[model samples]
Target: MASNMGIQIGNAWFQRKINLRPQHRGVHLVTEEILRQVPELLQFSVGLCHIQILHTSASLALNESWDPDVRDDMEMMLNKIIPEDMPYRHSCEGPDDMPAHVKACFLGSSLSIPITDGKLALGTWQGVWLCEHRNNAGSRRRGFILIAKMASPRNQSRRPFTVCIEGNIGSGKTTFLNNFKQFNNTMVLQEPVELWRNVEGMNLLDLMYKDPGRYACLFQSYVQLTMLQLHTMKSPLPYKIMERSVYSARCFIENMKRTNVLKEVEATVLEKWYDWCINHALIETDLIVYLRTTPDIVYKRMRARARQEENLVSLEYLEQVHQIHEDWLYHRTLFDVPAPVIILDADQSMEEMFVQFEKCKTRIFERCRQSERESRLLTSPVSSPKIGAASE
Candidate 1:
C-alpha cells in the first residue's frame, strides 16, 4: 500500500510534488509553471522555498529570465562540455542517457530561493530554468518545500506556548509530566514508548538493544517518523508540554552514529531529514525543560522501574546518552538550540522532585503570561497622537 508522507503547517509550511508538462529537450523557463502549481507561495511574507527535481536526467538552475539567447547559450555550453558523440560504456538507455546524468549532476538537482512579500524574491533578470538533457523526456516531477513566518492578529487565537522535556532514559520525565496533569489549560504529550515496545507485536526496542548493529537504523527511522507526528499534533489548550521532541531524537541518532551502530550513509540521510524538518516544519518549541540527572541515578531508577525492554540497558550506555544530551542541551555546542532552556537537578527524591516541579511550574506560567503580553503588543494596532490636543 502506497502512503503519502510529509509535513505541513497551516499557512506557515507548504509541501507539494507536481509534474511539469512534457517539453522538447532544452533549457526552458519554469518559474511560471512552478508558481501556477504552488499558489500557496503567495501566503508567505518572509521565508525560503526549496525545489528539488525527482529525476536524474533533468536539473534545475537559476539564470537569465529575460532573453532566450541566454538559455540557448547555456544548453549549447552544456552539450559541448559533455557531448553525446563521445563513446560511453553505459549506453544501454541511449547515447544521451549517461551524458544526461552527468549534466544533471554538474548543474545540480535542487535550488533554494528566498521569499519576500508573498512572492519569490528573484532578481529582475533571474528566473528558474528547467534543463532537459534527453531528446524525448516526458513530464518531470519536482518537490517543493516552503516555509514562512506570519504575524497573528491581536484578536486571533495564537498557537499554544510549547515546552519540550528532555532527559536521559528514566530521568523522571514521566513523573514530571504527571505533576503537570493536575493543572488546567495545559496539554501534556508523553513519548510513544509503548508503541515502540509493541510495533505489530514485534518489540523493536528490544531488538535495538539486543542487536543494535542490525536494527539501529530501522529503529531510529521509525522513531523519527513518530516524533514528527508528535511535533505536528495540534493542541487545544493554552500551553503544550511534551516529554521529548524531534530535536532530542536527533541526539539519539547522533549517539548511534558515534557508537558505529549506524553507517555513514545511513547517518547522513537521517541527518539531512532532521535538518529539513527543523528548518521547514512547524515544530515550534518555546522552552526546553532539561531534567538533568546523573547516569547512576537514572540507571538506578531504570532498574527499579523494571521495564522488560530496558533490562539489558547498562549504566555505561546511560552515561554515553547523558553526555550526548549534555553536549546538545547544556553545552549548546552540538545542534541548534530551538528555544530557551531551563535546567533542573533531577537527582532529587520523589518528594524533592515534586517540590522542584512546583518551583518550575511558577516559572513556566510566568513565561506564558509574558509571552501573551508580548503577543498582544505585537498584534495590537498602533495609534497616532492627536495633532493639537496632547503635548506632554
Candidate 2:
C-alpha cells in the first residue's frame, strides 16, 4: 500500500515460520510450497527475504527449478562428496545421520533472495530447493525474515538510543547503570534479578545453579522472556540503558549448548524464538558497553559479594562465561555483535571505573543528540518555494 504522499506503507518488514512436508533423500523444489505459506511476500515492493531451515539434517538452496534431473543430480553429487559408508564416530543414529550432518553443512541452511515488485527476483531458471538428506526425516521448519524500506519518513525519535551493558557475572554492570541514573533524559533499567530470584516463590536462578541439567531450560526460558520485555519497554527519555539484553541471553544459550547443558533440540527451539523476537519485536541496541574483566578477577568479586545463589558458582563456570563473552563481544568469533562495542577494563577500582564511565557517557549523549536532530528533520514539514517571487 502507498500513502497519499507517494510512499509505501504497511510492508516494511515481515516474518513467518512454515513447515515443509517431509521429503525423501533428495533435493526437491520448494519455491511454491514456501511462497504459498507466506502470501505476505506479495506485499513487499523491494527488499531482501532470508529463508533459514531449522534442521541440521536438511538444508536450503537456490538452484535449477525446471528439471527433476537437475535436482536428482545435485543430491547424487552431494552423496558422492560426503558418502555415508565412511569411518564416522557419530553413528549412533544411523549411517545416514553423520553423512546428513556433513551434507547439510556443505549445502548450507539458508537463502537470501532479492524482492522486486512484490515478487522474488530470481533468475528464470532459479528456484528454492530443500535438500533433505535423511531418508525418513520429519517435517522441516523454515523461518522467513524480510525487510523493505517504507515510503514514510524515518522518524527515529520514537526509538530511543538504547545501550546494553554487557559483561561477565560480577563485572559491575549494576554499578555502571547506577552511576548513570543521575543523568537527565536518561532511563536506566537494571536487570530483573529479583524476579528471577523469586518467580512465584520459586528461586529459578538458584535452581539452575544447583541443578543445571534439570532446570537449565526452564531458567533460561524465563530469562529470555524477561530480557525481551526489557528490550521492548518504552521510555519517554531519549537515552535508555539496560543492564543486559536478549543478545546476551543468546550468548548464554550458546555456552549452555557447548557445555551439554542444553540438548540440541532445546537449543534450536530457543534460538528460533530468539531469531523471531529480534526480527519481530522493537529490540534494537545502538551501543554495547562491554565491561571486560578476567575470569579470576570476576571470580574474586563474585566470592566477595557472595550471593547465596552464586555460592555454587565455581571459577570454572566463570571461566566458561568469560570465554563466551570474549568470543562474542571481544573476539567477534562466536555470534553477531548486536551493536558497536566499547570495551572498558572492569578489573579497576570504583574511581577508575567512573573515569571510563564518564568517557562512555559522552558518546551516549552525542548519539542521543544526533537522534533528536534526525527526528526533528524528519517530522518538520517541507516548505514550498514561492513561485514568481523576487530572488533574495
Candidate 3:
C-alpha cells in the first residue's frame, strides 16, 4: 500500500495502469476500462486514488465526464496553461516536454477521490483525462493505483449526506433551490422551515412561551430527518440539492447544546450523522451562497417573503441568524468547507446575479455530479463492517 511516501495508490473503484504511445488523445482509453470495473471496487468504502504518468509530456484532467462541450472547453483551457508560443528550453526531446510538465503541474500530479456505491467520486460532467501534452510517439507506461476497503451496508446507508447554504433566513435559499430544481439533475432536499411540524401538539406561541427546549428537540429532529431524507430517496432520480445540510444541523445543535436540551441519544445520533457527512459526503457541489445584506435589508426581504415562519422571526432572531451566517463563513473558510463558494451581494440585481450564476454553471454542475457519486458510494449496501468516518 505504501509504494512510497509521496507516491501512493489511487482508489480501486476506478484506477488503471496503461501503456500509451505519444500523440494519444480522446479519453485516454484506459480510463473507460477503469470506470467499467468500478462496480467491483465499490465494495471498498475508503481509499485514495493515485495516478502517475510515466511520461513527462502527459497529464490527467477530470473535466469531461459525459459532455463533449465541456471536454472541448477544458482542452481549450489547457492550451493556455502552456502556450505554444511561449519560449521553452526543454525542446531537445520534443516541443511539449517543458510545457507538458507545466501543464501537468497546472492540472495536478494526483487527486484523492472518495469511493461509495460502486462508482468513482467524480461529478457527472467530470471524467478522468490523461492529457497527452507531448509530441513524441513512443510507448509510455502510465500508472494508476487505487487503494480502498469494503464497508457494511448499515454504515453506508445510515451515513447522512448534507448540503448547507449559509445566509440570513431571507437569503434566497428557497428561490435558488426552486430554480435549481428545474435544470439540476440533483434532488431537492428541503430544510424544515416549519418549526410547528417538528414538535407534536405544540403551537408556535407555546414554543415562544413555555418549553423552548421542546421546540429545539423538534427542530433537531426535523434537521436530522432532512439530512436522512436525502439518503432515503432512490437516486437515478437526479442527485439531491439540500437547502440546508448537516452544517446547519451543527448550527442548530450547537444552539441546543448551549441550552442543555440535547439528550444523550440525540447527541449520539447527531454526532454520528455530522461525522459521516463531513467525511464521506463528497460535497463538491455543496455551495455556501453568502447573501451579504444589512439587517434592514434582511428584515425587508423576510417581510416581502411573507411566510408564516417569518411572522415570529423578530429583529433579534434575524440578527442571530445573521451572526450565525458570519460565524459559519469564518469557520468554513478556516476549515475549507468541501465545495466552491459563491458570494452574491444581496443588493445585486437579479439579472446580474443570474449572470454570475451562469458563469459558475460548469463548476457547479460538475460538483453536483461528484457529490452524487460520493453519496452513491457511501450509501450503497455493503456486506461487511468498516471502520473510520465516511470521510476518512
Give residue 272's lDDT in candidate 1 (0 to 100).
87
lDDT (10s digit) by residue, model 1, range 145-228: 333333211111468889999999989998999888777567677786755654544678899999998888888888887778
- Pairs with backbone N, CA or C atoms under 3 Å apart (clashes), candidate 1: none
Roughly what TM-score does model 1 have, to 2 decimal places?
0.60
Candidates arranged by TM-score, highest first: 1, 2, 3
Model 2 lDDT tens row, 244-324? 899999888988998999988889888999899888998989999999999999999999998999999889989999999
TM-score of each: 0.60, 0.57, 0.44
When summed lDDT is taken over every stretch of 10 residues in candidate 2, the lowest stretch is 1-10
lDDT of 1 at 296: 96
- Model 2 residue 345 distance off true place after TM-score fit, in angstroms: 0.9
User: Against the true structure, whose lDDT is highest?
Assistant: 1
| Candidate 3: tens digits of C-alpha lDDT, residues 1-392 | 01222212332233333333234542353455444322234334344455555545566666656656665666667776557767787677666567777877777755555565434577766667666666653445334444443332212332222244556667766666665656524445455443233232234433632555556565565556545444343333334455665566566566556546777677777777777766765443446565566667778888987865457667776676566666666545323455556666765556766765565555566666777788789989986646663743
Pull out the clashing pairs in model 2: none
Runs off by more than 4 Å, candidate 3: 1-164, 194-211, 237-239, 256-287, 330-336, 366-392
